[model samples]
Target: MNKLEIHSPNSPILLTASLHVDEARKAIASLVSDLLTESQSRNEAGSVELVTLDQAINRILAEDLLSPIDVPAADNSAMDGFAFNGDCLSSKDDIVTLKVVGTAYAGKPYEGSIGKTECIKIMTGALMPNNCDTVIPQEFTESSDSSSVTFKQNQVKRGENQRLRGEDLQSGKAAISAGRLLRPSDLGLAASLGIATLKVHRKLKVAILSSGDELRPLGQALDAGGIYDSNRHSLTGLLNRLNLEIIDCGIVRDDPASLKSAFLEAASLADVLISSGGVSVGEADFTKQIMQELGDVGFWKIAMRPGRPMAFGVLKPADPKNPDRKSLFFGLPGNPVAVMVTFYQFVRSALLQLNGANQTEPPLIQAIAQTPIRKKPGRTEFQRAILERGPDGRPTVRLTGSQGAGILRSMSEANCFVILHHDQGNIAAGDWVDVALFDGLL
Candidate 1:
């Protein structure tokens, strides 16, 4: 396997005769790690702000939040039952009767303490009285009147159905840590701890654009050899799902001047500039030229199928006066499926890190291949596949029609990516392969 060389800003560019030349192909793991490291170095740590619990979902936590008070501030009942002293029950297997002193509803606790053979009718979430240690569910008792109840002895263990103070969360403990993406349950947890507002990192700003003379915007009439730009739409949707602020710069012509203008403008306004097409070694590919002139960019032939040509670096201001101002750049492939695959695999985690999120790569599960797959051993392959359960309840996967990079329908029809590792060759029907589900971002 060829190792990906990490080049400095002044490193010399390696040129090959063909775009598919196999020399110095970068491993996907190394490329992703480098990208993340670079992104972290450039990350500004985002601004902090206070947002109410209702508005905190999907926001990244900016600080470690220690709970000021314990959850369930007082000991409470976990079920609607009769709260009593368990020691009063007889050790023999016979009926144990108790006199109900009072009824304790939720939020309205019975103030008086219970004596031996005395109990209180408690509702769920009701605070337990001082002497009560166990609760017998109402269904287990045969109570004809509100005065007393009778149940079989040894029916419930001591301290059963009772919620202790600080059981869910203790005081002065970290309720939520920094860099955590707040979920609905997280909001509820915060609310339970009386945390009305939270400090969270500001949303990331991403500027996206597309390049190619043959590409036109949606709803525009296409001339000969021209196609609607689906990449921009797809990229926009993917970025929007991340809850980041997106600046769509639309399409730039393949001319050098037009490409240069777009890159400069994007760098000035956004934290990350993402462009599709124009990274390949075609005659009209001026994006590479302009990117290199403005900043330190590396064009790489990743050892992967579907998406091979990629560019990653930081774009600085072309003018020397603003040398410190820069934006991260990711140049993706032109094909629709390739763009999505590369973005999900490489760009997504980097952006999450930039957004102050605790980034974790999605795990790939082992699934049985339902059909024979022809593959080469040198390059990694990401084939669109439909995953389903087999007769034995094991996960099975099959390719989604054609595996062409340009085939957008393959991505639309598939639920996961059947990942063939770089060293793996061909696969039989029953072979176990790794698959990444599209449920997270898709």
Candidate 2:
């Protein structure tokens, strides 16, 4: 078995990538490199701000957080046990007995000294009394009275069942590194270290707009050929998962004037603009034309399934007051499934880079193929599938109904994408495949 590091922007995921890059690299890798280079050249300082811990969830840390004091400032009992000197365990007999001097509760330490052959009943998290270096769980004591307790000598070792001071985190040491997206546990850890505020990257403002004359908004009547615009809603949900600030420019008509207006408005207000539809070679696709007129952009047919026609580049604002505020543009496919696939492939990492996050892609898992799948060489395919653990505990996957790009229902029913790499052929029932689950990434 070998490990392969697949990178998108600054995020690198280690997976078993045996084949995809031999031919597919030229298109996807080239585009990724260009976007990453541009993202790195941007002024990172412009995206940093100091925020309180209450408002720092999902935000990227701009600097390492050092602990102000040691965690568990003093040694404490790890469980409800009897605390005593380790020397008590050195008895030459099968059992050691000690008199109960007093009790120690959490927060209130035992002030009296623990003498020889004397122990204190300590609760969990209670500070270890002086001269005590070991503890035997209360359950281990079989012979016990009101004043004394007896336990086997070999039941516990020296310094057992005790939490050492500064063992978890030392004072003046880095508790959390920069570029980490703060989670609930991280906020708790910061509170433990007395950190009231943290320096974090400001949330990236992402504008979403869907194009096409046949598209209509929700809760509205539609014509014979018109369909509800789901692409914008899907893009909005995907962006919300990253905790970015959303600027909804709504749906734009397919005409050149309407498309150009929407493009200009999005670029001026957002750090990134994600639009679905109108990147194809259709006559109504004035999106590409307007994007090129506004800034430098590229329209490429990616060698991938579901999402092939992709547009990526920078959209420079026409506003003279903020001419330097340019937005990275991603024009995704019109199909709902294609929009999601393309977003995960490209737009996700680009947004993470602009938001100052160090990692972008989610970890890839491997599962056994439960159903036979037909494939052609030359293009990578992301098939929606249901992933489950077999009776033997190994993961297995099967396709979720029809694998059509327009069928968004399959994407909703599936838990993961069974990624068949480029140059790969048919997959038998027992073949191993790479999986990207939607648990955290989606």
Angstrom error of the Cα, residue 279, model 1: value is: 1.6
Residue-level lDDT tens digits of model 2 in 49-102: 998999998888989999989887999999997999998777798889999999
Using TM-score as the measure, which candidate wins?
A: 2
RMSD of model 1 against the true structure: 4.2
C-alpha lDDT (0 to 100) for residue 104 of candidate 1: 93
Error of 2 at 343 (Å): 0.8
Candidate 1, 343: how far from true, in Å? 0.4
After superposition, candidate 2 runs with Cα above 4 Å error: 1-46, 283-287
- Pull out the clashing pairs in model 1: none
Global Cα lDDT for candidate 2: 0.81
What C-alpha lDDT does candidate 1 achieve relative to the native structure? Answer: 0.81
Candidate 1 regions exceeding 4 Å error are 1-4, 7-46, 89-95, 139-147, 150-154, 283-286, 318-322, 389-394
